[model samples]
Every structure is written in C-alpha cells, then in structure tokens.
Target: MCQRMQMPIITSRYWNMVHGTNPKEVQQDAEGMQVMQVLGNNMAFGLNCKNVAMKMGLSMPEEPEFTYTNFIH
Candidate 1:
C-alpha cells in the first residue's frame, strides 16, 4: 500500500510486532521494544530529512495521472 501511494515505508531490525498477552508481558519482550525504538527513530529521521529538503526549496516529484482498467464488462 505504501509503495502504491509512493509513501516512505519505515522499517526496523525485525518485523514491527510484539508478542504478548498483556502490557507487562509486552514490556518483557526486549527485542520487540528495540524494534519499536528503531522504527520510531527511522521515521523521525526520514521526516527531518524531508523537512530540510523542503526548506531548501526542493519539491516532491510530480505524480503521474492514474489509469483505471476493468476486466469485467
């Protein structure tokens, strides 16, 4: 979906997920916490970069017109 929308997809060291039945259990998942942190940092960095680019008068690429296709008649 992100690709289709030409949006940046943030990622981490692993899948952005935490396995737990409760908040306490989730807190125990060290790896999951790390992944979340990494994702957050990445997103922040990306946004900062975009902001800087805009300040420099850089603009986003123009989006092409969309074409629809139907298989059913």
Candidate 2:
C-alpha cells in the first residue's frame, strides 16, 4: 500500500503584536508596523465605532470604554 503526505500552512503569528523589530524576530517584525498606518489603512473601524454609538443613541463616552452600554430610548 502507498500513503500520501500532506503539509499544512500557517498564516498568523503572535509576534505581529510587538513594535519595531526586524528579522530580529517574527513577532517584533510583524507587530512593529506603524500604528496610524494600520488604522488609516482600515477606515471601517472608526465609522463602525461611530455608527454603533449612534444606533444606541449614545455619545462617545468621556472615559471611552466605547462599550456603548448606554442604550437610547
């Protein structure tokens, strides 16, 4: 009998969270990307946050827990 071998591909890495590290480490390298670059790259985050607050008839909390726990009547 013959058997077939298979390999798996992994896409995500935890090191992506750290900031400003080159080949030094995968985690630091990936995470180190600019902040505004990431945020500005994705417009939906801000709009989505605002929409959620508006739907609840709530305003941006001063403390900014951003939970939108305040329900609008």
Which predicted model would earn the best TM-score? Answer: 1
Model 2, span 1-73: residue lDDT tens: 2322233222232222444345556445434444434644454565676679779887543442335565777
Query: lDDT at 9 for candidate 2?
Result: 28
lDDT for model 1 comes to 0.86
The residue-level lDDT of candidate 1 at 54 comes to 81
Cα lDDT of candidate 2 equals 0.47
Q: Estimate, for each residue in 1-73, the C-alpha lDDT of model 1 and write its tens digit.
A: 1123377788899999987999999999999999999999999998998889889998777777778999899
Pairs in clash, predicted candidate 2: 15-27, 16-31, 20-32
* TM-scores for all predictions: 0.84, 0.27
